[model samples]
Target: MAYEIMFASFTFFSIMRYLITRFTIPDAVQHKWRWYNVWISWIHALCAGLGCIYCVSIEPTLLNNLQDYDIRFAYNLIEMSTGYFWYDAIDVGVLSGSSLKESLILLCHHFVVILCFTVVVVTGDHVPIAIVCLLVEINSIFLHARQIFRMAKIYDGPFYTVNKIFNIITFFMFRFVSLSWMLRRVILDRSELSIGYFILLVTSFPLMIVINFGLFLQVLAKDVPAFTVLQKLQGSKNQNRKEKDACETLNGHMNGTHQTKPVMKAEVVSKLE
Candidate 1:
């Protein structure tokens, strides 16, 4: 069933990519191939994100017993994602025009994911842990959206801004926070896990941390400039507000002095009379 679902998932994404490229994306769009590639990825992220959430929601206790808990849907989701990664690895690394140097990191990432997922799918152990890792796809949903929007030439707007914020937030939550929790679980449950699984977890954890941190820094580097521009705009507004208040204060003082002089002259005239 898992292998069947895995092959089906791969075929489904391939068909979707074809249909999207054939009918959905306009001919006028530049880099149509890249768009379709990212489009499929976005679709996968949406599916995988929701699927992971549902699987976990139905069996919240899985987190407590990562080694013991097993659910059919969880296995299916892992296989499904594994299929997508396989497709992506081929499409991006082999078919795309990108140089090997440029595609090296991404290919390596896909390789690691497929390898780990294959181990879990074959052994039927650590399905819960795999599901937890799939939770990172929740962040990928936003991460891919950022790419789609950029491809669509939507660098800034309300929609883009909101997506950007969510992208950064989920990157932290799912990637950093969730991965951290999983690391803790692995450490605490080390005795229960098999030697192979334990070794895999220990080896993968540092790589996951380094890769995610690097990606997080890149995300910050890309998104932080917008924040800096916002800060500059805000500072200018604040400065203008202060200047307006200062002018108002000067006008008020000038008006008070003029009125006081008039009142003093009136008093003097009354005293003279």
Candidate 2:
């Protein structure tokens, strides 16, 4: 029932988002369809993320006892989060029009999240893992904000600079901190969790971290050196082409002179006469 409601809510939110962006912000819609989707999804992720964090923190889930977290609220929260992941996997892939490889990565990510969390929901155990996974959303908030700014054409402004800084900081903080905590939990408390659940939790957690780290490196590579190395490479190519064109022009002129030299004096003399 929780899953059904959350799924319906996400579906409704997507439809309403499309309508509002299409009608209300027609300009952005016309120009940045992908951005429009990002903006709406960002809102959804933020809300769901905050709800998970609040539920996890307040509930005695993370209060030094993993097996003691059999609360219904946390279960419902994870279920909702799984629905949101389902929505994101489909929506982002369809809307972003990303490359096949990129789309697959995201879809696989969503698949893992939904599958693992669904297991936890069913067993009423490993709720802590679901909560930790949602911590990535803390970083998502700023990351999505940065993407929104870029799509809105505000990337060159001061606000974007601040947003980018926060994005990076939050990314490192949440990703590293969450990963470390999970690792510690796995190392010290392995006896408590079942082998199957432990395997799923361990595998899914590191997979997300690896994927996120790869994406972070891509961002650094594309955005940082793009302004410097790519520009310089382009300039050098243009310069070399110009030099080649100049040489070709000189050679053409010399050939023309040689062909015309024998007849030019007689032609000019006849015309003068």
Candidate 3:
């Protein structure tokens, strides 16, 4: 119940943040590469999160159905032991994996978790994981805030001005509040040590780092057009400068010739008169 309530509140804030972002950024920037990366990410997140929820609901039968309890238990231990930790780490990973393949990836994760739980099913110990997920969701809101302000500053469109800074600051506050709350819990006890444990124990963090890098790659791709335009403008300025220099050189040469030929022109005019 604590997890659900906390997560619910976080989700509500995320929804509002999305709305703020959608309004703040220009349609161009919002629909561009960064936007698409986030879109796919959220889609995958929703799918995986929902599937995990489903697995949670049916956890009772999962152990009974397993052919080998020990194997199932091992899988469950590895999966659950490092679950939340892996997700965050992978979010910042070097690989984009597949923007379009979010659903499939999440399904696999859900299956893996179910298999892990079957190995050693403890009926009542789910509360801690649930709370962790809630806190993680809240912390993720911070990730979005930076991009929102960065894009707004670049585009100067929509609510891209002063009021938007308040929204950004608010996002920071929410993140600190939620993250500090989770950190406090973890700091005081061994039971709440999943995040720290996973950080030390899992490869998921590297994967998430890759994903963040990939997202920036996408953003760079979107900026390519603007970059190209700037390059063209620069080239045009250089070309104009070259033409002006050539014209000035030609005029100067003609002026010099006229000055040198003046004596002969005057002599010819006197002879004609």
Candidate 4:
């Protein structure tokens, strides 16, 4: 029941956002601010909330929920990207006054940390999976902070700085807390940390990554023919409906059940002719 409710809410939110953007909402936000801080803050809440819920819920580790919120979907019930995820691309470019070398180092560290984490999963080593995830998350938060700092001057007042700082601190704290919970779970019972849990973690994370990356490339290549495909599909449906209606009419008439036209007197028919 909880799963169904969450899935429905997630889908509703996604559709509402899309409709607003496509039809009702203006191209610009009312505050004339980019959603950089808002986006990061959302991630923080998602991680913390899911982490909490996992501990509270009677299902698998809140990691499922964590992925949903982190992946920007309340649920990954669908295999497609569904526009419920982050809109901005994974930006690598840092702002002015930021050292290019440091950015590269952070980016490389991000990849390396995640790679090690991946290796652990592939080798079925859940022990260090939590640790590696923590490291990678920290690197990711640093990269975001770096960009935010560089872009501070471009922002109005000190709003960006303050909000970004909050975002960073909250992000770090949540991830750390979440990691602690996993560690405790592992320590409490080896059986509690079985391959079943590991498999879910391993399978879901990679699937999300692959699906997201593919969507990114599809968007970049400008080959997402969703609307065109939809139009073609609708046309086919309409054609099929028309044919079905014709068939029904033909069957009714050929079965000698009714006249094709209204009956009239012979004099009236002769005059019309």
Could you say which candidate leads in lDDT?
1
The alpha-carbon RMSD values of the candidates against the true structure, listed in the order shown, are 15.2, 13.5, 19.3, 21.0
**TM-score winner:** 1
Model 1: residue 86 alpha-carbon error in angstroms: 1.0
lDDT of 2: 0.73
lDDT string for model 3 (70-152, tens) is 22333332243334323322432323344535544444443443333322233333333332233333323334443554654
Location of the lowest summed lDDT over 10 successive residues in candidate 1: 254-263
- lDDT for each of the candidates? 0.86, 0.73, 0.42, 0.41
Better of 1 and 2 by lDDT: 1
Model 3 residue 233 CA deviation in Å: 32
- lDDT at residue 240 of model 4 (Cα atoms): 100
What alpha-carbon RMSD in Å does predicted model 1 have with respect to the real structure?
Answer: 15.2
Pairs in clash, predicted candidate 1: none
Tell me how far the alpha carbon of residue 68 in candidate 4 is from the true structure, in angstroms, after superposition: 21
Candidate 4 lDDT, 1-273, residue by residue in tens: 323533453464445434533533233433212334333423433453453344334334334322112321222221111112221112233321335674554354334434433333333344233332443234244334434444443333475456445544544454444445444444454454455654555454454344434533433233225645776799999999999978876887889865545434645798989
Counted clashes in each candidate structure: 0, 0, 22, 0
Q: Which lDDT tens digits does candidate 1 get at residues 1-273?
A: 878988999999999988886666644458887888988999999999999899878988888877766567788889899999999999998789999998998898888889889988888888888888999999999999998888777789999999999999999999989988998989888998888878888788778878999888777767789756776799999999999967876787888743467558978999999
TM-score of each: 0.79, 0.71, 0.30, 0.31
The positional error of residue 254 in candidate 2, measured at the CA in angstroms, is 34
